[model samples]
Structure formats: C-alpha cells, structure tokens
Target: MNRNDTLVPQVFADGFDPARVDRSRYFLSLLDEGRAAGLFSEALFSLRMNELMERLAEQIGLWTNGRSSSVMQETAEALLNNLLYLLDLALSAAPEPRAAAAMLARTPVFPLYEAGMLAARRHLDRCRVYELALKKFEAMVLLPPGPAHFLHGGLRLWLDERDLRFNACEELYVPSSVFGRSRRLRGVAEAEAALAELCERLRSNAAGPV
Candidate 1:
C-alpha cells in the first residue's frame, strides 16, 4: 500500500491546484484537528480513504504507463498519508482496547507506522506523523476508562514530551505502580488521577538533581 520511490515533500488535494495548496499537508492538518477533538467517524474515514485510493490508483497507472515524475511523487506521498490516516481510524474505532499488559507486551502497528514514516521523511510529514501516532494511542488509552491500560512506546514518548516523562520500559516504577500492567484503573477518575500524579512527578524530576 506504500510506494516510497515516488514520494514528494508535498501533495495537493484531489482538485486543488498544487501551486495554491499542498493537499497532502492540508489533509493531514485536518486529520490532526479531528483526532485532537476526538471527532472521527467511520463515514468520514471511509469517504476520504476512498477518494485518496482512487486518486492514487490513477497516479500509479499513469506512472506505470509513462514514468511520470509527477505521478510517482503523488502516489508515494499519498500512500504514506493513507497509512497514517488508517492507523488513526483504527485507534478511534477501538471500542475495545486489549488488556493493558497485552498492549505493553507488544504494540499493534505502532512500530510499522513509525518505520513507514521513514519513507514519509518529508520534513513536514515527519514533524506530524509521530505526534499523530502518539496522540492516537493517547486517545485510545483515555477512552471512557475500563481495564488497566498501558502506554506503548509511541504513547509513552508522547506523554514524556508533554512533561509526563514516563519510561516506556519502566515508567520508573512510578507510573508502573499507578498504571501498570494490571486492571488497576477501574475507571476514568482513577486514570485521570494517576496521570495528574505522573505530571507532578515529572515536574519534580525536572526540578531536582541533574
């Protein structure tokens, strides 16, 4: 589904003039806004994915028949964009999160997306994808609250950046004690409290020693 040999740094919308807008960047921005607001719908994801796939297919066919630089570049960028979006959709639709420990034991596709992102190495896309990926897991863990939830590597890095500084492997046994691999987080209130405590510890960590 990804073809990096032909990716460009920017892609415009299906109909928008590239001279006027970078559609790939624009679409990604919208995805960011949607994810942040916890406002995703299967309908929207389906519609957008369909539209992008069609355009990508056309570009691939064109390039296949006639080696067009323009076509190849568009296809490459769009492919990575699609994966990023698809992962977002999956995270949003997780009406169920696996056992918290199960998640920590192995991230589902976080690593895959992170690797594909190397192919998506255009500066702008790079800036956005990791954060988006982490945000997806963040949103997933913060769901109405249920079993003990765990943060995978990407999500853990995200929390750390936001001043939470959890050890992806250890959480310094701090968050591990609070949000460890058990069904400890019985509800949202507890989860929120734990996150608050993590933030406080991060502040202290920042202020003390080294």
Candidate 2:
C-alpha cells in the first residue's frame, strides 16, 4: 500500500514546525518533564495511541487510497509501533526512570507518530551500517560481553557526539538527534570506514610492547 519513496525519514514528525522548535530537543525535553511528573506508562500510552488512531482513521484511509480494512489496520499498527519507539527513546534518556509508566495524555500523538516514523527509518540505516561492520569482526572475541558489544559501543558513540567516550551498556542506544542531520547517509561507506577503524583497534589490542 506504500511506495518506496513514501518511506521518508522515520524521524520526521508529520506536523512538527522545525522553524519554531528543535524537533529532537523539544520532544526530549517534554519527555523528561513528563517522566519527572510521574508519567510514562506503556499501557496508557498504547491506549492513548489507539484513541488517536481512531480519530485519524479518515485521514489514514485517504493516505492509504481506500485500501482494504486489513491493510489500513496494518498501516495504523506500523505507525503505532513507530510512535511507541519514539516514546521509548525519550523515556530511556530521562534520569532516575520510574518503575511504572503513565500515558502522556497531554502529549500530541500525531506529531509523535510522525517523529516515530522518522526515527524508525534512520535507526534502520544506522543499524545497517553497524551490521555491515559486524561481519568483519565475527571471528574476533574480547573479554566479558565480547567483541560485538564493544563494536556496538563504538557505533553508539559515533552516532551521538554528545557522548565523550565509549560506555558499554546492555540496551542499544540510538540518539534522537542523529536523525536530524541534514546530510543523508547510507550504510556502505560508513560501514567500510567503521570496519577499517575496528581493524586498527584490533591490531592495537593485539600488539605488545616494542
């Protein structure tokens, strides 16, 4: 039901006015404040998203060109997943995250959906870049969590400049701001470069005092 060109940046919000606000920082800040206020419930967020979808059914139908109900539903479901991913990123970035979450009732779902779509696409390309580099390191192993984790750590740092150094973590971190870059990046050249850098690091690790 969708064209290849229709696959726009998954991070671009449908109605966000970038001239008035920084898309990445704006959602990030609201997410921070909402979490501090004891919001961020997944169930509630899903429920709210459902309600938002119901309201947008007509618009969705128009976009889908009167496709079958099932196709439209599938489209809505995909969009919902994208929205949830966006919220997950925001909450993950907050300090002292609570054990529970509440719905972001005041949060605008439409813009969130748009942002989610954009994020999902950018994340895929970034992942593609990393996966390509990973193939070269399959035989290499390192201490504890192993080489894969270390390689991921490097990519995460490269993706987000706010970070000063590589910090290994269990969760995969995708920076919201990376999708905001003006330059378009496909994974090929980046993967080649990353592989070269990783090979250099491996050699350094294997080297002994002269």
Candidate 3:
C-alpha cells in the first residue's frame, strides 16, 4: 500500500497485457501473491458476498411487492456481478495496483454494492428511452445487400446483442477481436439510427431519388 513499495518486479508491475502474458495466469499469480500476503481470503469474500446477496434480494423483493425467491435471487446475483465488474474496472485503471488491491481488501462490501446499485439506477434512467428504441430496432430486418453495404463502407455499428461488427468483406468482429476500431454505444438510439440510415440508403439505392 506504500507509495515507495513496488508490489512485483517491473516486468510484472504492469496490469494484464494479453500480448505479454495470459490474462488468467497473470491474475491467478497476483491472486496467489495477495492470498499469501493476507490481503485476500476466499472464505471472507464469500461470506460477505452471501450476506450482501441475501440483503439485496430481500430489498428487491420489498420494492417489487414480493417477487418469487428465484427471481430475486437471480436479480441479486446480477447486481453482485455488476458490483464486481465496477471493482474490476477500478483495479484495471488504478496507477498503483498493489495499493488498489489493498484498499479493496480493506473496504467494506456494502458500500461497493450501494455504489454499484446507484450507478445501475442512473444508467437505467439515462438509457430508458433507448430501451424501446433498441426493442424496435431488434424487430426490423436489414433487407438484402443493405447490411453488407453498410459494413463494407468502413463504418461501425453496435447490434442489440452488444456486439460491434465492421468490415463486411473480411470478417465480423466481436468484443474480443484484435482488429478494427471500436466505439461504445452512447445509447440505444445510436444503433437504431445507424440501422435507420442503412434502411434509408437501401431506399435511395432502389428508387434513384426521393
């Protein structure tokens, strides 16, 4: 946790770089080191998570006027995953990985859960309009050569499934693809607009002009 202390050798100090090493192996090595240093405990983490899950499920049930236990449990699990995802983002962005891990270990679980829940609420509110837009987009079919032409034009678009594909001739890309440019969808409207533009292009190509 000290600024003066480097956690590992300089080679290992940098965060997970796929080109340099395997991601799972790198994280596993770090996890082993943290466990050895008493900075991590599977038992303690599990206990805290279990407690948080129960509390979250109960609270969600109350808000929903008592949903089935199975539904509440699944929802709580998803929220917990969201909280961990935020924690992962924090760790990845930290300049001091060792100190970040130490701080994470020292932090209480509920505060992190609360923060994640608040973030989810804000995101849902911001994207609410996009919800119906995405649904409508999903229902439409990208007739014939329209999809091919759109991608072949070197433009990128996000699908409702959260995958971004581009460069129609060579390959379709997913999140893990090492090639092509990437952009996060600002909202469902962005994707919907892209599809609408593609459809309009099809109409123009078919009819010559309006």
By TM-score, the best candidate is: 3
Candidates 2 and 3 compared by TM-score, better number: 3
Relative to the true structure, candidate 2 reaches a TM of 0.33
**In model 3, how many backbone clashes occur?**
0
For model 3, residues 53-96, the per-residue Cα lDDT tens digits are 66556555654567555555565555444445433333433345
Q: Quote the lDDT for 196 in model 2.
A: 53
Global Cα lDDT for candidate 1: 0.36
lDDT of 2 by residue, 1-210 (tens): 333122222332233222432233334443444334434344434545465566356445654565744454665655443334454443333342221122233335554445444444455455556555454545554222444554457555544432101111113332333222222332223333444544556556557455
CA lDDT of each candidate? 0.36, 0.41, 0.40
Candidate ranking (TM-score, best to worst): 3, 2, 1
User: What TM-score against the true fold does each predicted structure earn?
Assistant: 0.22, 0.33, 0.37
> After superposition on all CA atoms, what RMSD does each candidate show versus the true structure?
18.2, 15.3, 11.5
